[model samples]
Target: MMLSSMTLSRKYVILGIAVAGLIGSLTSAGAQIQYQTGQNVAPVYEGWMHNDDGSIDMVFGYLNRNWEEVLSVPIGPENNVQPGGPDRGQPTIFVPRRFTQPPGERREQCVFRVRVPAGWGPKQEIAWTLTAHGRTDKAVGTLDPLDEIDTHVIAENRAFTITEGNKPPSIQSLKADPDTVTLPGTVTLTARVTDDGLPKPPAPQPGSGNAGGRGNAAAASSAVAALAFMGDASLDCR
Candidate 1:
């Protein structure tokens, strides 16, 4: 579907903000190189949001420079948010570049957020620093008017419809039996999802040239079946 001009502009604005937040330098040669492993991760400051309760959330994400490696660094000096603490609810699991995205939209964006009080000053800052592959980089958050983000920004970034009553499906619970296993072992997974049953399937008319008695429902079901699992869930044995 074609994106509205407003949506496209907002998306570009967020991207510009992300680029401006990078705080350290890296070798220009590294940008041309794609490695399967042994690459650094850069924390990204996506933007900030104004909450209804007068609090603001500083959104953040990451870019794992590697093309294939997935690193798990526990919260500490290596992965930290400063001024308030070493842990600001940031992620420990860093996955490789999102190759699935279209060319310009690949870097992971808006993965998590750190909330700041409404009284937070415009000059105040929150810094998320990450050290990986023998290098360090940071993303700083502030109350810059140009760096504010909202639901429309997110909808545009995710390429999802933002109708008044439209809501995305929620995964209530997802669990894997045993949560871990040795090599050559099978793990059972269960997920419970809840939805509003939106965009109900089109009704079939007597002779509209539609195949199958279910009309569009069959096609919808097929599409859902094909997309039953929406993310990459891989176990790394290292």
Candidate 2:
């Protein structure tokens, strides 16, 4: 009886130690799996930028706090415009992050409107929300009437016709539709106009930098994509 009691005590001690060790291992494994989460910052509206066509652009910037790619930062469905519903306004934007910008730093001018509709008046506001990684950010901008002066005036006033960044825009695919119209009437014209100063779009051009334009809504996305290509240094901006 004494020997049996002693054996039972030894078995209990061994089982307790094994159970403790397993708990410790699990705790250590959990520590290894856990990590820090990053913040997805909202875009900053840079205000209305003027275009030569008597229209203005809504310039914006953003920051992705994570070091990795924050894919598909989309505008939320609840986001909308007043008096005309969402369709009367711009569509939701898709802003993704790449290595072009340093992690956690604001990517300035990441996106911009080629042109905002005219007659928006001096103080119109649009609220937009972008969501990514289960995080949401909202930004609002006043479509302030463009307070702009002629660039030619500034350059000419100083007798500086050409500056370091001065670039002459190209008129690509310029055409007058209905080559044979009714005698001396108006014919529909179509063309792509791009400014050569900024980053080129992802699409390759024969031999050029970025292209810029504020065309019909149908062509807006394509134009924006081409403009993005200009940022590629491999394309040789020229």
Query: How accurate locally, in lDDT, is each candidate?
Result: 0.74, 0.50
> Backbone clashes per model, in order?
0, 13
- The top-ranked prediction according to lDDT is 1
**lDDT per residue (tens digit) for residues 43-117 in model 2:** 566556567676766655554454444344322354433334443333343334443334443353425442467
Off by over 4 Å in 2: 1-37, 74-105, 108-110, 144-165, 168-238
**Model 1, stretches more than 4 Å misplaced?**
1-32, 98-104, 174-191, 197-238
Where is model 2 poorest over a 10-residue stretch in terms of lDDT? Answer: 227-236
Error of 1 at 225 (Å): 14
Error of 1 at 39 (Å): 1.5
lDDT of model number 2: 0.50
TM-score of 2: 0.40
